[model samples]
Target: MNTRSTSRFSRAALPLGIAAVMTLSACGGGSSSGESSGSDTDTSAFSINLDDCEDPASATEPITDTFDIGYSAPLSGPVAGAVELATAGYDARLAAANEAGGIDGVMIEVNYKDDAFAPDKAKANGTEFIQNDGVDALATFGTGALSAMVDDQNAACVPMLYPSSSTADFADIEAFPWTTTILPLATNEAKFLVNLIQERYPDGVSVGVAENPTASGKVQGDAFQEVAKEMDLPIDAVVSDGDPVAAATELKAEGVEVVYHGGVTGTCAAFDSARGRIGYEPELVLKPSNCVNAVEYIAAGNAADGIELGAFGKDPNASENEGDEGVAMYKEQMDAAGVPAEIQGNAVAVSGWTQADLVVNTLEQAAASEEGLTRLGVMMAARDQDYASPMLINGIKWYSTPELLTGIDGFRPIKWVAADEEFVPAGEIISIRP
Candidate 1:
């Protein structure tokens, strides 16, 4: 739909450019502290060499000839259905990269473990990856799992790439230089939703927030409130629990005009059921992707009628994007891998595939550099690189630098049309910053 626009109202609400660069300095001495010194010199291209980095690399250590990375994801939990699809996407891309001879003929290996969506298990898996596997980096998922092991990963100086989380804190380069999250932060997504709210409900509307009753859910819900406050959006209801129907009922009773779900598919579906049962229809928004899928739709039936997905990627089932090369490639790989046609179109799977592609590109860039490919070099490659996934909406190029840690800055709001069983772009892609 190519309707992407810079959010005007929220830009005034949040920090911009250099002023935005200082938000995480308290954590790990942001390497861009020097560039933010109000210099007249052109500092946009400044490279970060933070003095407080936890595990400084030796200048003389030659880059390793081969690389081994670890992947920690929940493969046997309630989320396993989506996690397996994501892993399938990852495996598909990794197979393609390896078949192409792998970054200057330096073979790449991956170690995988199922943490069962348990934080304690995830920590144990991270320990094994660090101590026994000696992986150069890791790809992880689950908010709880990542939260439990991020500090451990940082202490080991093992860069964790693209965990399936949108928590703004994960992008704090100063505190967690070894960590990089792939999803757009919830705060940023809030800006787009706010713009939509202002447009559709011009007179101003009260918003309600629903969370999953977990530590991470509370963190995300609080961040949404903070951003909503910044934008002067009134929040009339805040519900946190496992039963989304009850939460939705509470919001409905409050006469809220819009509901922002800061939870997963189950909760979102529950809200839909509650709305349908009570005949209360409000503008609903789910964030950072993976909130709903085919299974959820089938379960909720017409309950999912007008649900909106806030995401940074292309709608895999969008009819307009049928010929997209990346989507085509994804289908072909899934077919080759024997993935069910139904699950192959899953957005979570596509995101996993995209994440793997990004990692491969970073490794390729690092391997090509004269500095060669070491753990530090991999981190350097990931920092500030501008890359576009063919599968992303409008071909949006995701960017990150030492000073700016958020990998994505915007999202394309999509509405689920249950009749057609597809998600279509509802508006032009909206950016949080200019």
Candidate 2:
């Protein structure tokens, strides 16, 4: 877990603020586990049938005639570049869908708000999208902001689809009924990192966590703590701060041999900065959100020779397999959009595209609902729906239930190879324990 950066984007304007506030006020809105051998009746043995669209056999009917989708993210924050990439994927998908004749001729409209990675701001914008703009669902990014608005969205019965938060608390389907995530939960990432440590350094592992004070950070940090205690591994130090350099220094003093970062790209930059100041560097483990776009981090002069990270989708930077439709589509759209090819594979864009697809699918389902297109109705339709978007990590499936919409069970580890300046796959997918 690493500290969150204090840097703010210079381009965000007051108009964006007013729009977010207005959106929130207007709608009045207000809005995994291991495989197990079990009996057929066992809950763990159940799986959704993706081929089942609806009871009326509307699968062949165009879904576009029915509804619209909307989203809000940090389009103007420190993470904007990544956000833009994700949105581009969404845009391309939307265009492709439209070109193919939208779901039943119901055109999907995507409205986005720039929360700038601020939780309070996201909450406000979320409320506006639900209440004022009349968006049937929301696709959001960042953990802190989504957590901030969970209560409102849940109470309002607005389906918050494909939020980018991977925190365990958010994965508790029973607690937050209206929200779902697209990536493997952060708790899983922590578990995978710990498992890797145990296998590689069986003697004794000195673990360090750099965490932010936000809800997501705390959940991931707690997971690491629990696993270390369970395994009886020596916990070097768990540091919480907004400053990465200072946290790194403290971890170094603690003789930390393995570091787990809970923050995003900025935290990686901080770790890089700290590495420069001190002579020592530890094996780094990053959260899914932090690991995407390693080239930029490396180019910034961060030595990522021994870094490993958990990933939720196919790494764009990784070598592509022949006829990989998702990767091919991503590259085509990114190039056409004039986005630099280097940043195509980053997690931010993949997340954005995945979330957008969720929105699109939810809207398609909602249109077929007999209850019409109200937020609650749309959410109900989305509940328990199953679909595999092109952007999910390989061999990972996206699912949702009435109580919990995101899958918590999947994640893979990736190790950064300095020679290629890319993250190479490390191991098979593993589960995150509760």
Candidate 3:
């Protein structure tokens, strides 16, 4: 089983005052502006100090005379292992690009910061990246961190691509022009779960949601409720912050047939601990982030039996992905990085690669200018671009539509078959209605 450890990108003790001042200066007198025109026009008419990381001159010099991207994620905290896998994936993609001569003779320079999945640290890192590093865009992971920096991301006009968040709020392009999500929103996953439950237990099955009290948790819980209502399924209970054993026992007492979990590993541990005490393990439906790999759940042994999950991508261990192109590439990269095969289902890695692809594709579409890359130029180029590559998941096409800024929809339903130790696809890919 893979260990759950802290991330490497732990919070820094630096004061944020300097970063705040730099952020203001980067935004051109702190005024919001509309999207730029999609022409080859030189939008660099106005200039701001692009240096602050080291000496002012070092800042002006492009990290590699090409595009520079900054990434923030929990590389050290409780979810460190997960974040590390994601970083590895991004590194693998960059390695491949560098070997191939990079994007149009310009190498992608990735500056990484560890947030430990903390919101304040994420904000501080975002400020630092925007102000000091002067990155072309911000790429990150974790729902809590991304949610906290929504305002700052929008204000700066910096294109934030593929932060590993699947919340519906991040999908709103009108509100968050610069923000785009790589994973399908929790609402879409919830809807797919509801449909599966209806098909499996059609006699109005009893459903329950075990969620955290955070904004992301509430959104997932609400999505579950909405889907249940639409499908006319009876929701037995919605538990928050209670004892997992006690809650599961109570739900079992109420004859709850299905349980939907919207929390993280700790919550999974809690639920697993309570399984024996409750005397029954209801069908478990977990959110994507919580169900990326089987190690955690498999550690629970019989407790995780009959557990089902909705995923936006394929699990690396699944038989369906065996010998596939994307999975093969992923395995090669992991081997080169010396990452254990057991922990290969790191969704963050896939997300990181996707983000890198998006950046490269966008840069490919934009015209080279002495003024360099503009926000509008990159965005407009990304709007119509598509990648015809194989995804880790079989039978699931990974791309974005015009309705959503990020070219990704929801995922196919997958069942955790402990007997085979793989996540078997439940059915065909389901389209998410925006």
Candidate 4:
């Protein structure tokens, strides 16, 4: 979110300016209730029995060979640090898998390209990866970029595995069967935040939602509003994409106690700056999927202190997670990628590793299938999985099914302890699904 700070990913050469815009219409409406769980009978594309893979009778012979996995993200430009860290997770875990003799003796070779966080470039990279590179599956980041290519990826039938986008529509299995978003849905995140307010601020809370002018941003703000209304929280203030200082001033005047940011990383930092300038401090919460790059918030000096976030994974700065295997894998990968020691464990990096872990795990499942490995088989393997990775909270698992595409249903609420310089879990992991 902080423009000045550079994570390991920004070390690459500056790229030429290219831009593209995308919008998601299917994701605007928030879910009516938070009860989580998923349906259906589409098994035409997959040759192997989907049920058999759930608990295969005998391990199928996996093709012991090298495989290509495509990766696309903004490797340059303003948000490069977070985007790069996401892919760095991919690189780290893949390296670990390879060192461990790969998934079922098959090596994963990630073919990466810099999209500059531009939608057009992402589409180009995706096309090349699917058509020319001949990758079995693809991994990607960014909501706008992924939204732009849903039709194309679905047409190509190449599984788009574990993209970093948190847009709800990316997980629409019926609409785009070939892709799966690993992050929690934006609407679900809004509900969880509202639930947090109801549980923690039970003594009548006044809330404000900071939103960007874009359609996706509006959808996020609307979601929070819907949930806040359902939970009976007082909505006293609202602001759109404009001067952060003005927005902060108005919210403070209204005595707002909590601010739910429905914008991107820059918008979050801007609000932090404004709050610092106006001395109007409130509980600042950003969309968990995008807020993982807390390094951006921390870069705002002391103004970024005490920010709260919801996550399916541990914060890189959380000392309680020092002994975590996922944390260790993250560090090893960052060091392997030559990331500076200070920049290692932010949200982006943690997410990268988690997503890569999902991909490799599914690949292993697909390889063990009696029908052997194929793109559709790999995609089908991701359905109805209850995956427990190193980064998830101890008891929670990333669960999925044919009917529900959102992989994870719960998030741990964590607060940034500026004094201690680490994120401490504020509450237990809350499950929204059944």
Candidates in descending lDDT order: 1, 4, 3, 2
Error of 3 at 251 (Å): 2.1
Q: Which stretches in model 4 have alpha-carbon errors above 4 Å?
A: 1-64, 213-219, 265-267, 283-289, 315-317, 329-339
Query: Which whole-number lDDT from 0 to 100 does residue 190 have in model 4?
Result: 85
lDDT of each: 0.67, 0.58, 0.59, 0.65
Q: Sort all candidates by TM-score, best to worst.
A: 1, 4, 3, 2
RMSD of 4: 10.6
Q: Itemize residue pairs with steric clashes in candidate 4.
A: 36-433, 36-434, 39-403, 292-347
Residues 1-434, model 3: lDDT tens digits: 12222122211233334232121111111001111222222222322222222222222222235466667777778667656656676676666665667655666677778887788998998888777766767877767889887777667767686677767887775566567766667766777788877888877667777776655567677888887788787788888735777666777777766788776533354575576555766755555444554556666666666566765555566565677766677667667756666555655456555556555555554434321245544444444333433443444433443345434544666666667655666667676534
- Highest lDDT, which number? 1
* Model 1: per-residue Cα lDDT over 78-193, one tens digit each: 67777776777777776677677877766566777888888999999999987776677887786788998998888777879888887887877767877888877767766776
- Candidate 1 vs candidate 2: the TM-score winner is 1
Top TM-score prediction, candidate number: 1
**144-244 in candidate 2: lDDT tens per residue?**
88887788776555567777676667666556645677656665565677777888887876778787766656666777777667767677788874776
What are the candidates' C-alpha RMSDs? 10.4, 10.7, 8.9, 10.6
In order of appearance, the predictions have TM-scores of 0.84, 0.76, 0.77, 0.80
Candidate 1, superposed: residue stretches over 4 Å from native = 1-65, 265-267, 283-288
Residue-level lDDT tens digits of model 4 in 278-354: 89888655454466466666666577787777868766556687787656656776687666666566666677777
